[model samples]
Target: MTAASFTAGLRSALRQRFRTLALLPRLLHSFWQTSPALSAAIIVLRLLRAAQPPLVLFIGKLIVDEIILQTASPAPGPTLADWVESGRLSAVAGWLLLEFLLVATANALARIGAFVERVLTERHDNALGVALIQQVASLDLRDIEASSAQDRLQRARTQRFMGNQLLTSLLSQAQDFVSLILFVIGLLSYAPLLIVLLLLALLPTLAGEAHFNAKGYGLNVSVTPERRQMDYIQIVGSVAESAKEMKLFGLGAYLAGRFAELADKVHRGNRDLAARRTLWGSLFGAIASLAYYAAYAVIAWRALKGELGIGDLTFLAGSLLRLNGLFERLILGLTQITSQTQYLDDFFSFMDLRSTMVAPSNPRPFPVPMRQGIVFDKVGFRYPGKGAWALRDLSFSIPVGETLALVGENGAGKTTIVKLLTRLYEPDEGRILVDGIDIRDIDIAELQHQVGAIFQDFVRYHMTAAENIGIGRVGCLSDRPRVIEAAQKSLAHPLIETLPEGYEQMLGRVFARGLDLSGGEWQKIAIARAYFRDAAILILDEPTAALDARAEAEIFERFRNLSEAKTALLISHRFATVRMADRILVLENGAILESGSHEELIALHGRYAELFALQAAGFQ
Candidate 1:
């Protein structure tokens, strides 16, 4: 590589590595946020534990020296018990007892540190999970649907997998570092060159570990989209909703086979990286082992030549062995930290993304207690990444207290309009106005609250019947009476009454003993959500597609009564349904092709009439 390119590549790698470690402070802050007492305990305990290894080794040396001195002095007693009783072994026993106490105290401190670390890990994981939920909830639909976003999300999700590992590695590495410093000091007193030799031998191993860790991180990022796809396939094959369809289609084997193939691909990539890492690691480990043995011979010769005493020889050798082991462990811990930190970058980077749909700093309230109603004034929007506009120059008015129906075939921008109206997305050009004011200036929360909508793809939450409707107005989720009232308005109360638990009955097949409703029944339950909402502009985006003719009529009848004082926007392909609206707009190719009453459109014999006649012929 040329100098510029090489420098850029190195900079990129360093930047990525730094980004990975950035999560460390954030995680520590989360720990402190979780429990200050636990945080303090962890730090103090790690410090105590850090000193224990050196203390134990030094004490062992003292015990050996004491034994040698006592042995030379000779004992008057013969038997072991007699020696103890006559106090001949008292000095040696005291030395041994002291070493034992130091070891015991260290073990206790280690256990306490582990316990506090474990608790802190759980708390940080839980806190991050909550933070993730809040962030995801705040994100627009566009943010969640992007493939790049999904990959980033997958990487971020891996953080939970490393939650405990990150904490354990960091704290353990800290303790080992302290032990290493003390060992170096003790070793320096005897021969400092051994430490230099040891580092030279271990450099290859550390370099190998770091290189492999970077490779593993790179593979993880590359395979995220594939991994996410595999997860989706698994969900569809095994989950309750798709179970029936999967069984009917015999897709079980197909999905499983696909999953296996994809999983094997990921496994092979990981194996290849791991195999090379292991091979290099073994070679470097042998090199380190050779250095240690070579140093051992020199220490032994010095002791034989009387340059060092027996106690000094023992302490130096022991310290050399410990320092080598601790240094190796510290390097391995650091590599592991680097690898795990890459996953953490996923989370922090994902959280850093801000939505462009944010409201103005000084926001206006929804023109609540409305006047002119919502107007799409020279508005245009194209979904992210799509070259063509989903809706363009779509000027229309949802006049206050009027039932405005939108008619369009699939991909004709029906739902896109609803999405824009609800501020799930913002227009790329022009603006949407609420009353006489631009919606961009309105408080996002207030705007959303005033535009209660139930899209075609609304969630079927695995919750109780009451909760399903109550979630629409979270403030009244616990208000049983309001939930029942909303259910009654959507005509779901009667269906709910037929259930074993009435309003308390669980919905969806995801949960145990949860009842699954038919399409029409589900439609009723979903409509209840919009009914429960306190929005001034009610937007129903093809939410009644599953309902039968009579049920559709009854629901619309109720909708009419409830929406009399509220502005209503209905989107549907059912021609029979659109006839009830005060006015109808025919949308084609992202623009308004026709705007009039159903009778006028039918008389005009335009696209609206053509489509109406086509569907009308279906009954014949």
Candidate 2:
């Protein structure tokens, strides 16, 4: 808002304008690729439409001249019958009909063009949405979670929503530019000075438009974080995911108040900018009107002095008025095109983002039947932008065909280790190996395909009961028998069987006739999904965190039977479950404190033993 900042913004806007102008061809290419037939039709329509305006003006001039000639000459009688008898009315009458035909045809063509434009714009918008979704799927978790990326994504989404209007503006901009050129040629013959004066008048208006557009864009980008937060607050207040929590906490008034506060701030900023823009715009527009009339007055004086005819005066005035409008539109269109291009930068930048979480071009073959177990050689990992390590100097092994239970308190690196094993996040130092081959060398998809994990915070998709379980093994999503078997193994089948629609019953309260399960029931469904995977390495990151003690025991007992032949990784705070594992690892601060059989650890009476005894004492 400061004078210096405003000046800097103006300079930046100018640069953005030229840069965007260079990218205009890319947009044209996108349109062409959406539908070649529609693209060609639009171009043809614009060409015809652009030439029609100047042609109509010229025809008007001819009609006016014919009228003047007929009135001055003593060729026609007062009555139409007498004029027809003398054959003096035919020439002027034919001229009027010719002009009428041109105008009628132009109107018909405009209607056809509008229909074609509507279809083309819809197709382009759908195509863009598909492309954005595909690109987002390829992005890394880190990139997708970043606040800056979300801002860029928000702006990009806004631009995408303008597909229909953008297409119209582009075609209109092209048409107006062509019409302006033709109008100039017509004006030059009458008085070249009028054309020059017209351009000079529009300069101030152009500058004002460009300045306000930049300010508007600046404000939008600055408030993106707030906008994203506002959206989140609204979702939390109204969405099924948070409905229970919101009501439980009595947060309706608090959330509404917060939303009002943020929305008002954004609205007031926009209102202030609009007021200034309108004031300057009005002044510039008045100046433009004055320039047009100055040229009209000059032409009228020439006509009165017999230097020009009445038809020439009329033609010149009409042409000046049209040229004035076209120039204004062209300037405004240029500003809009330039402004939208800033958002296009965000979209293209996101599309160009390359994730570090990709397989090598020449990937080593993944370990089939992974023989020698998984190993961590002095591994360390820290999340992006975090100063502290999530896991550091961690060296361990989980032998093939063994169930290793990792016991730890919150933030003890147990889940981080699970993430590393799954290759969701790679280590900052050292390496993890599968049967002596570095896991990084394996294909990313292949690595993921072999390891199935259900974290504590698993998603409960608002889909059919069958789909909820089958999503873990997408290849078997439609295989109903497989889904039922997995559900039975996870002890979720009994509850699911009671649903009105059975396996087809919709989950969550989002839809009509949908069923919302309790926390523990949802956990059963999540565990069933993991079971459906039938992965070689099954990881349960406290998937039973929501279950009661008896339910937890029964679920793990079923898991032990189902996974007897497969390697497993279990993370739980429950010492009772920990004692069932082939081996126990106690972790703290992302490093392993002790590791042994449960009996050996209890015999040693270390941290693990003390924690185990504390829990056992509670039971007694």
Full-model lDDT for every candidate: 0.84, 0.87
| Candidate that scores best on TM-score | 1
Expressed as tens digits, the lDDT of each residue in 119-198 for candidate 2 is: 98888989989998988876776677777778878877777765566668888999999898998888887899878898
Error of 2 at 365 (Å): 1.9
Tens-digit lDDT track of model 1 for 239-307: 877878898999989999999999999999999888877887899899999998998999999999999
Q: Which ten residues in a row have the lowest lDDT in candidate 2?
A: 158-167
In model 1, the runs with Cα more than 4 Å from the true position are: 1-15
Clash count of each predicted structure: 0, 0
Any idea what lDDT model 2 has? 0.87
